[model samples]
Target: MYGARLQRSTCTNCNAAYTRRYLKVQRRVTPAVALHSRARQRAARRGLPFDLDVSDVIVPSICPALGVPLVVGEMRSPYSPSLDCIRPALGYVRGNTRVISDQANHLKGVLDIEGLIKRAVASVDQRREDYARLAAYLDRELLLADVRRKAALAGAAGEEWAEVAKFLDAAFVRADWKR
Candidate 1:
């Protein structure tokens, strides 16, 4: 009887098989790798082998469900915490690449933006109230009771202050509230 043809390479000891393919990680390309990529792109334009340069990254070696070596290629990059690209590539591929865009990240940015807007609106309203109050506060002559050293020097005063409040009030009124 004849042995089966060498379909792929596998570690005899652990039976870890690896195919030739790689998954491109969505990362900030480094200067060196960027240079390589540029060269490859140029070569392709000149009708040459597209695989001018190949990088590597050591990713999951085995399937989580079967424990069999999952054919995968590692991506070389300098950026940390970069995500995997969703496109089909080669290094080693046993199955289609699954990339889940972390909705949590978008939600976090949205939450942060919401908080900032709320704080800004509250501050703007306070500023408007304070602006109107200053005119009234200045009119009080004998200084009312139950108050200490009521002065208008802290904020909202002077020619520059008035100009700023005028501009900010108009801006606050027209500020986009629709997210």
Candidate 2:
């Protein structure tokens, strides 16, 4: 009975020590790699495809959506790497899943593609209105300049001469300033 107890104690302690050593080694990896490894393990357990290697794709350390450097941390933290699903409620497929910054992932969660499109279209419309106003102003200025030039060339009097002289002075001044 004593021999059997001793043997069991040695075996269990060795096994526990080995498990602890393995976990310690895993903990030494970077947070981004560790999180990705955990996701791959989960995908394997769920019978999903996860063939991509994190080392191959994440060399630059930049977030794809935000276009900034990656800050390794746990899930849902700003600048931290997080796994994103291309289509909501779908299993993790090889091509459909990607790692992105947590901030971008959270932003995407609140706004669908359609909502983003609507916002972009509205912004473009407002910009177009501003551009229309600018173009109208330029057109009127060009017409006035042309009239002044014509009147000056035809030897017209005081106000027309002054207008043409001012316009020419402005044009020459701008040209000199560029140089």
Candidate 3:
């Protein structure tokens, strides 16, 4: 007669159970990873050909435009890697895309090198105009004060100084200020 029903579990069964649990845990993806996957899927659905895998995309720690650190989020942060096409119409081709911040992408705006240079030159010209205007104003104000002082000194002196003052007034006239 069987004494007590012998109860035993095989090492193989226990090991298989442990392996399945571990594999299941490992398969779980983080939100960032999920977002990236969704992006790829969306791109594919749009009929655009994307050869690069999500694993290959490197998320930068900093926003290149704003010069601030990037935080992981569903919409903008994870999706912040705005794929830039160097040629502007390359259509998501590999090697043409570089990751940049959304703000940078917006600022870049149409990506015509000539247009960008023209904008930069215009900005520089405006700054120079402002600086020149201020300099001219200061120069005129200071020179006018100096000219008034010289006139007062000439008026207080004698006839001999009157000839000197005449010369001084001529010089002031040449300087383009009131004597």
Candidate 4:
């Protein structure tokens, strides 16, 4: 039984020590290796911390978005707007060409807007100046003449304004002289 027998490790749990041990492994002399074991040993081997071609292992795309904000022509309409539209509104600012005009046709609009405004304001001043007038008229504060006067004064077109007042005042004085 001891011939061709070999020493071996025993069960660790049993605390069994080998002293001419009970377990035995038979050793044989063979001239060649088996085809299966030889092929396995020759197989492609890899070491620890081996690198894998995980590029195709599942990755996301890194390309940018679809398209950029390619802006086109943002120009105004081809047709031009009308002149009347550009002109100022009528009633606003009473833009009448008053206090300056021609004589033949006198094509001037009498609405010396500012002068008219001045007169209107003067009417108010007359009211306030005379307490009796305010009471006599009924019940209302006298109007502001300064506002109308200033408006009338504005009738003069800057440099031409002073001259225009002289011309109009002359006309009024002449009319008064008839009396």
Q: Any runs in candidate 4 off by more than 4 Å, and if so which?
A: 1-156, 176-179
Which stretches in model 1 have alpha-carbon errors above 4 Å?
1-157
- For residues 92-172, could you state the per-residue lDDT of candidate 4 as single tens digits? 111111111011002112222343344445555432233222122111101122223344654354436555545543432
lDDT of 1 at 79: 15
What's model 2's overall lDDT?
0.51
Question: What are the per-residue Cα lDDT tens digits for candidate 1 across 1-179?
Answer: 12233643454423222212111331233323533454356545655434333342222322211122333223432211211221113211211111111221121222233343444355565443333332222222112111212222355344455455445434322333221
Model 3 poorest ten-residue lDDT run: 1-10
lDDT string for model 2 (11-125, tens) is 8876666666565455344654665677688777877666656652342266544454566533335777767654434545443454656665665553444544444455565
Instruction: Estimate every model's Cα lDDT from 0 to 1.
Output: 0.29, 0.51, 0.45, 0.23
lDDT-superior candidate, 3 or 4: 3
lDDT score, candidate 3, position 81: 50
Candidate 2: stretches off by over 4 Å = 1-28, 41-59, 73-76, 110-112, 118-179
Model 3 residue-pair collision total: 0
Compared with the true structure, model 2 gives a TM-score of 0.40
TM-score for candidate 4:
0.14
How many pairs in model 2 have backbone atoms within 3 A of each other, for residues 3 or more apart or on separate chains, i.e. clashes? 0
